[model samples]
Target: MHDSTQSRRTARNSLLIMVCTLLSRLLGIIKARVLGSVFGATAIADVINFTFNIPNNFRKLFAEGAVNAALIPAFSSLLGRNEKHRCVRLFALLCTFQSLLLIPLVLVSYFYGDGLIAFLSDFDANQVRLGGRLLPFFMVYLATISLASIFNGVLQAHENFLHAYLSPLLFSICVIFGVWFLSDRYGAMSMAYSVLGGGLLQGSYSYLMVRRYEYRFKPMLRPQNAPFKEVLVAWALVSLGMGMQIITQMVSFLFASHLSEGSVTAFTNSTIFYQTPYGIFFNAISAVSLPLMSRAAASNNAPLLRTYTRNSLLSLLALLLPSSIILFFLSRESVSVVLQTGNYTLADATLTALVLRPYLVFMVFSAWYALMLRLGYSANRHALMTRIVFLQNLLDIALMWVFLKLGLDIVSLPLANGIAYTLGLFILFFLLRDLFPLTKEARFFKGLLRIVLANLPVLAFCIFYKNLGLQWHESGSSFANLAYLMLIGSAALGIMLLSYKIARIPLLSLLRSKKHGGNLQGDNLIHLD
Candidate 1:
């Protein structure tokens, strides 16, 4: 009975997380549409993407990866032990430390922004100058991201993921609003500046929610506490993990520099398209899984941990694999429709699609690797995960060079990433098996087989439907094209759901949740006492 209740709670919490993430991604899609409509992937759009990458890279390094990885697990441990005040103090110290660290970095990036752009982008003098002019404004955006990240970690620590999960909508809104209203007035730079303002707003909104939940921030350092020390260790591990991505970015930039004149822009645009699906589904699932995984580990519940991990991974695979197949088939057309407007030429769209084809293949593996790493973190094996991350980066670098030397050219960049992630997934699978041998429930594998079998027909139908839609769009009226697309997409989704039902997978279990049903297993979703 207790286990049933716990599982019920877990399901409810998971549902809530999905709801917020869905809302956030919906806004993100709308935001992308606005950007597409207004700027139409012009050189100006290139400037925005390129310039913002400077600060945004830092945001990922410090805020998204390292800070969250280190902060959440450490805070959870302290909170679990009832060291409440110490946890608060740790937050204050880290906040101060982060502020101090970012100030100098942001200023340096701001002042020498042009030089950095020149060095990294390897673009012509004029492009470098324009990128520099736009980079400083991104400092504000980076700062906003940093603060918001901290608040998000705090929320997750308390198992209050709703606000943190939903806050991204505000960012999407700011960008869409800025482009819609200010694009004509302030031109391209105004859109970038609006992003800056949006960042500030997002940070403030998150902080207010944290305060409302009775969490306060102070400007001080107290690094001597036990929790602080743990955070320091976790930080070291996550820093290593975060460096993998930075290295990948550097490799990508190098390839971008040597490619044709607009190759950099082409790569950036296509990457954004690939990232949309990734951000909407993969990232959201991983984010929700982290805290839940941590809680399961804290309580040493092996069965529940395995169940959650497998379920999350299965969900990722069930969606990502089919999406990847569909995207591969439609890559060129999708790229053209989304980005081939105004100054963005057919050549740019073609190259972007060419690169996207291989790059998106990594999505499934990347999502799986992310979940595995989080599982490692939950198990308090940061040291092992750190080593794995270091090796993964080394492999990525090596693969990138090998691909270049083999004359695979620019397309090799994404291929290298895809290969690296495939390797990472294998290693992760072994580690997971070794770490929780008992939790490798055979039922999970059976369920996976069922899902795969059910998906075969669905994939075939989707491809056929997509082809028909494309043919109609080419010859039919605009309304007819629209109708065809809507019909196909809706049909595909409906078929997938129907397949889940027929296969007897738990896809619809959450929808049928009853008050007395408790959890599907003795799982605790939020784990907030």
Candidate 2:
């Protein structure tokens, strides 16, 4: 009965986060369209991409990735122990300390922004100088979003996901309006200022939500506080692990910057396309399951922890496999319809699509790695996760180096990322064998095989439909191409649903259980044990 209830809660939370994330991603896609139309794939776009990448990468490291990984598990454990007051205190302390820490960092960034931009990007001196002027504005996000992440972590610990996810949409909206209205006058600097504005709004909204949840902010900074100490200990390892991953990405982008003129822009654009579906689906599940898994681990409920871990992985594979296939087969059409407007030319679309195609190959592995890292965190295995991430980064750098040596150019970046993630997924599975074995009754490989097999018809239909003499580029109109692609995609989806139904795959059944309150244990297609 408890298992059933927990499953329902996980589904509910996942649904809430997923819906908001889908909406946000949709808005973000529009934002990307606006960026592509206004900026095109030019040196200005490359400058903006590289400038934004630095602070945004740190935001992930300090705010989203490390802080959440360390804080959420500890917060959840505190809640499990009925230590609400300490949790609140720890929250305030984190906020205060992060604020104090960011002030000096922001100042340093302002002073050294030029050298930092030049070091990270391969742009010429003039462009790098312009990007340096923009870096400080983006650097402000490091403070704003880091504080917001603490509020978000608190909300997630309390299972209040709605506000936490919706707050980011404001960031996207502000950037869109900034680019639309101010880009002509102030150029990319307007967009940089808009990012700062968005971060402020997002952080403020998160702070309000924290207050609404009855956690008053008293601005405490207690270095010796036990809970704070615990968070710091976990945080160091988690940050190191996540920092390695983010650094690997920065290195890849650095390589892209050195490639062709618009290689950085193309790479960034293609990554946004890949991340849309990933954030909407895979990330939503991981976010919801992490706290539950932490609670299970705190109580030493190994069975429940294993169940959550397995279900999350299977769910990821079930969705990611089909999505990847579609993206891989229809990369060009997808990129064209979404981004081909105004300054973005046909060559730009073709280049982005080329980078996107191989990137989709390991989308499932990316999702799996995300979930596994959360699983490791839940079990307080941060040191192990750090080791895995460091090794993964090493592997990624080695692969990218090899590809560059072979003269692969810009495409080598995403290809290297995909290959490294695939290798990392295997490494993580073996590393987490003691906490959550992959060979349990919910056999990971067997279930993955089922998902892939069920997707075969959909893949076949997409191929057959594409060969029917309809070409996106030659279709003469974007609307016409979009209509045809939608038609074919809908049919492919229908075929996938039918295949799942005929095969009694567990994906749909799990979703149905969420709505109907049915027992997933009785769904013979899945092994819960």
Candidate 3:
């Protein structure tokens, strides 16, 4: 009874987070459109995008709940034994240490950001100088976001998710406003200033949220405690895993830079399109699952852990499969409609869509890799996760290098990423096989087959949708492009609904879920817990 009730709460929280994430993702598109409209795919655009990518990558390791994942286990462990005061102190101490470490890092990046920019890209001296100057603003962004993550971690550990989820939305809003109002004068530099304000506001909001609790900001530095030691180790391991990704992305930037004048923008923007699907589905699942899975792991609750894992996997595929297909088919149209306005030309949008095709493949497998990676954190299998991640990252880098040597030109960037994600998904899945035990194989595959069947027709429709007298060709107007995509989307929706009906899938059971039922072995519809 208790477990079922908790599951209900979890579902509610996940839904709430999903809605919040959807808002943030939309706001992000606005930011992208604003930036793209102002600078198009020029060097200034590349420089701005690349500069943000630096601190953005750094911030992601902290932002995407690695801090929460690390801290949750420690907090869970301590609270399991009734040591609440220590949890508070440890939170304070960890925050103190994070700030201390961030200061010097920020100083270095701020002072020599141009040199760092030059080292990372093939930009000429002037563009390098421009990127360098902007790096300081984003570095400040890194600090603010990094600091915000600690508070987010604490709030999430307490299972207070609303404020933690809102920080990103708030940050995006600030960035959009700053860029819109200040851009004419500050130009690209306005983005930097906006980032500064956004980060500060984001950090402040989280701090205020945390203040409502008994957690302190006294700046304690007692790292020798056993609880603190466990947290430090967990955080270190998590950082190591994230560090591999950070390196992989930086190398990707290097490869993209050499490809062409605007390759960096295309490469990065294509990946940005990826955020739509991930945020709408996988992000919510992972956010809600991670802390729950951590608790389940700590208490050795195998049944509960199995349920979360299976449902999360089902939810992701059920959502991502069709979503990836539609985007894959409409890649050019999607990019064109979303970004090809103002200064951003159709040629630039076309280049980005081509880059997006491979990323769609990467994005699908990436969902699995990410979910399993969290499972690794839940199980505290950091060393194993570390190895798996590094292996994948190294393979990706090597493949990128080989592709360049093979004279594949710009294809090397996304091709290497796609291969790495495909291989990494298999590797992680194999390593985490115990979570999806063989006894459940019959049900898992059945549910998976049903999901596949439901999407097969949608895939077919996407393949030849333009052939049915749909005037989806270029019309030189953004409204026309958007309307065509909308029509296609509406038609696709009808196909999926009919397909679901034909498959006898219960569409509402998952949404109005009253209890956690079934698993990966369900016969028709996916049964969400």
| Alpha-carbon runs more than 4 Å astray in model 3 | 1-7, 33-54, 61-65, 76-83, 106-138, 182-193, 223-226, 258-265, 341-351, 401-409, 438-440, 464-471, 501-529
TM-score of each prediction? 0.81, 0.85, 0.84
Cα lDDT of candidate 2 equals 0.79
In order, candidate lDDTs are 0.72, 0.79, 0.77
Give the per-residue lDDT digits (tens) of candidate 2, residues 393-459. 8988999999999999888888888888888888888888877877664454566677778899988
Better of 1 and 2 by lDDT: 2
C-alpha RMSD values across all candidates: 4.8, 4.1, 4.0
Q: Write the per-residue lDDT of candidate 1 for residues 1-529, one digit (tens) a residue.
A: 5555644554455566767766776786788778778877677677667787767677777787788777787777667667887877887777777788878877887789788888887577877887887777788788778878989888887877778876767887888888788878887777667888888888888998888656677887657664666777788778877877687787788877996688787777778778766766665566656776676677776655766676677667766766776677667666666556566766777788898988777888888888788888877788888888888878988887888889887787788888888898789888778544525456455545766787877778867865564433333224545565566556766777787666655542322222222233322211211
**Residue pairs with backbone atoms closer than 3 Å in model 3 (clashes):** 114-132, 443-520, 443-521, 444-520
**Span of ten consecutive residues with least summed lDDT in model 3:** 507-516
Candidate 1 regions exceeding 4 Å error are 1-50, 106-137, 178-193, 224-226, 256-270, 329-333, 336-354, 359-362, 403-411, 438-440, 463-482, 508-529
Worst 10 residues of 1 by lDDT: 520-529
